[model samples]
Target: MNSQARLLDKLCANIAPGKLEWIGLRSERRGEVVVIDQAEAVVGLGLVGDHRMKKTPGSARQVTLISSEYIEAICRHTGHSSIDPRLLRRNLMISGMNMNLLRYQRLQIGDVILETNALCHPCSRMDEALGKGGTAAMFGYGGLCAKVIQGGAFSVGDAVIRLPVIDSQERLFP
Candidate 1:
C-alpha cells in the first residue's frame, strides 16, 4: 500500500473516522491544551493575555489550524481578502484531506493523540472575528474540535501518525 493509504488505514483502526484534515502550531508561550469541547475550548494561562496568548482564544481550537495552502486557495478564489494566520487561531493548518471524510478517524499529530469530538458549528462570533459575512463562507469549513488524550510537546514539522491498520475481520491488514 502507498504511504497515504497506510496512514489512513491506521487512523481508521483507532477511531470511528480514520482521516486527518490538518495540523496546527503554536509557540510554547500559549499554555498547553486544557479543554476541548465541540463548540469551544480553553487553554490555561499563567497570566491571561499577558504575552503568550496568541489571541483572545489561543487554545480554543486545537489540533486543527488553517494551512497556508488553504488560505492561498481561498484568497485566490475570493480575490477579496487575504487570510491572516493570526486570525485563524488554529494550532495546525492543513490541506489535502477531504474534511467531510474525517469522521471516526484517529489522528495523532506529534505527541498529541486526538479523537474528533464533534463538528464545529458556526456562530455570530466567527462573523465578527473574520469580518462581516466572512463566517458564512467558513460555515462548512472550520477546523474540528478534538479532545487530547495524551499531553506532550508538539512543535512545528512534527509528522502526524494514525493508529495501526486492521481489516474487516479486526485483524491487522498487510
Candidate 2:
C-alpha cells in the first residue's frame, strides 16, 4: 500500500469508542419520537418498535445516529440554550464519538452490530422540530444512517465499538 492509503486507513480507523446515551422509537412517519431505555435490533430491519422496522430489505436508513457533540453544536448554531435529543429524531444519541467517522464502518453495541451507510441529512422539518435556522444549523452535521447487520438487544450506556475493516471486501462483527 502507498503512503496516502496507509494514512487514510489509519484516520478512518482512529475513532474512539463511545457510549449509547439515548434511544428513540418513532411511532410513524414524521411522528413524535419516544425515548426508550433499550430495544432489540433486527437484521435488515431496525429497532423493534421503531417505524423504520417496516423499511424494505437492506434499507440503509434503518437506523440513525447522532453525537452529543454535534447536538451541542447544533444548539449553539441555532442560538438555543439546549435542545432535547428526541426532537432531533435520530434513533440513537451517542456520546464521545464522531458520528461521521462511522460512515461505511461497522459498529458493535452489545450484541447488535450496525454498518453505517450514509449521512442522514437534516430534513426541512428541522425548522419545526428544532426552531428557525434549525435545518441550516444541522447542515453537514446531520449525523449518520446505518443498517442493522447482526441483531440482538442493545440499551443505553452500552459501549459502541467500531469493527476494524481488514480491507474493502470483508468486515467482522460481534
Model 1: per-residue Cα lDDT over 1-174, one tens digit each:
556656655555443322223333344543333222111122332112223334433242344544455566545544546776545555555454444445334455555555543555545655655667656656556656554445444434444554443344232113
Model 2: number of backbone collisions = 0
Model 2: per-residue Cα lDDT over 1-174, one tens digit each: 556545645787778799999999987988889999998999998889888898556788889999999989998899988889988899999998766567768889999999887889999999998888899999988899898989999999999998776666453222
* Model 2 steric clash pairs: none
| Number of clashes recorded per candidate | 15, 0
Scored by lDDT, the top model is 2
Deviation from native of the Cα of residue 135 in model 2, angstroms? 0.6
Model 2 scores worst on lDDT over the 10 consecutive residues at 165-174
C-alpha lDDT score of every prediction, in listed order? 0.46, 0.85
